[model samples]
Target: MTAPTPAAGAPDRAAPPGRPDGTERARGIRGVQPVAPLLGVLALGVCLVTSLDVVTAAVALGIEVALLPLLRIPPRTLLLRTSPVLVAVPLTAISIALYGRPSGRHWFDLGPAHVTDGSLTLALATALRVLAVGLPAVVLFIRVDPTDLADGLAQLLRLPARFVLGALAAVRMMTLLGEDWRQLGMARRARGVADTGRLRRGATMAFALLVLALRRATTLAVAMESRGFGAPGRRTWARTARFAGPEWAMVGVLVGIGVVSISVAVCAGTWRA
Candidate 1:
């Protein structure tokens, strides 16, 4: 007999050849392994942290700015995500300028704070460094899926499967917290208990959320244990986490940026320990 046809309303199961399914495509940055961006960020951080000079940070920041277009992030989303870094850079600069080791000609002096030429320079370098490091990290992790990251950690990096899976579960559960909080608030409002004593109401809601989270965690742990998640046998993955050319290239670019930034700082006699 001929093969049977699918049900009339059955969803299409076969993805187009050489193209990712909807779920994989939604994870973003197709063809680049999840671990690649993580490794790139780590390499960049290591390179940038070695120097406390303006030249190094400025160079890295400039390079990052030039490469932003390649990330393909929408302008609005980028701004919204990077807003924390933007706010933090100025605050960090101000703090460093006021309290960082005082040297050179003093610009301002207060009871226990001083702003000097040296501190000013340091502040500027620090601001740029924060922007350089924080911006790329924020952007790179924007579309990272918890499951994908866990897969990468376990398969690509050879991390402990139990730990990776546990952390992945925690991350997945954390996303539900926002919805839980909203539901709790609505429930409390319906009972007419959230209209007054804002601080007390918040504390009560938080305690309730904590209890719920604990219960959920306990249930999840039991379910996972029952499912052989913590078994001693070698674990297998559903999806292979590949570290290929694109991943390597991504890492190389970040490392190269770091190296060039440090080299410029050293050559310019602005390098610091």
Candidate 2:
């Protein structure tokens, strides 16, 4: 047989030296099943919620911060996504410090509100706990695609397909809410109703948005039902959601962090329940 000649413009499939191939590159945490991170977050939250100790929350928060580099999130994006938590933590701490159960020496006092040593400590713990739990969740979810999550829930977790798909649709629709609100505002301005009282304009816009959302939901339900999504038969998934070694390892790491945090708090005698 004659040897075949190379075709013109054929691309090479081989990876360059010291560089990862497509499959190797896809092996990062981003490629793991979505359920793994979801369960991991839940486990971490459960572990932290069991105690109201500064030690546990602080330890967990420290570990989470250390792992931030591995998540490969840009600093600006991380800050923006986690801004809500950052703002909320201070508010939560302030509220708790002022109104929390008082014990030990009092630092400040007002009508039905006191900032004591114990209350301050409790407030700090609560704030840290919220940060520890919320930070990782926001970061992890930033990488999770809604479709992938729905697939994982339906296939790997054995959840009802209808529920998973419905939730996924709802998530997808949430992104449109900003655009919808903008359009509603423009319409109101065109109709000369938006230049009035700010509160009244906001109230009217909110009601309109609510009505639009309900209408969208009804239309979507009808469309989905028409497409046989509401059928009670076995459904085949387009992608297989695998819960293999990597997913297990991710879950294990989160669980280990939780256990160590709890253990440290217990040993330090700071654990409260």
Q: Each model's TM-score?
A: 0.89, 0.82
lDDT per residue, candidate 2, 1-273, as tens digits?
Answer: 998756888865675322244343223366888789899999999999999989999999999999889988899999999999999999999999999989999987898899899999999999999999999789888877787788888998899898999999999999999999999999989998889799988998899999999999999999999989979878987667789998999899889889999999999998886
Candidate 2: Cα lDDT at 91: 100
Model 2: weakest 10-residue lDDT segment is 17-26
lDDT of each: 0.90, 0.89
lDDT of 1: 0.90
Q: What is the lDDT of residue 123 in candidate 2?
A: 97
Give the per-residue lDDT digits (tens) of candidate 1, residues 1-273: 998899999986876433255443436366577799889989999998888899999999999999899889999999999999999999999999999999999987998999999899999999999999998899988887777788899999999999999999999899999999999999999998989999999999999999999999999999999999999999988788888898898899889999999999899998997
Tell me the spans in candidate 1 whose CA falls farther than 4 Å from its real position: 1-13, 16-25
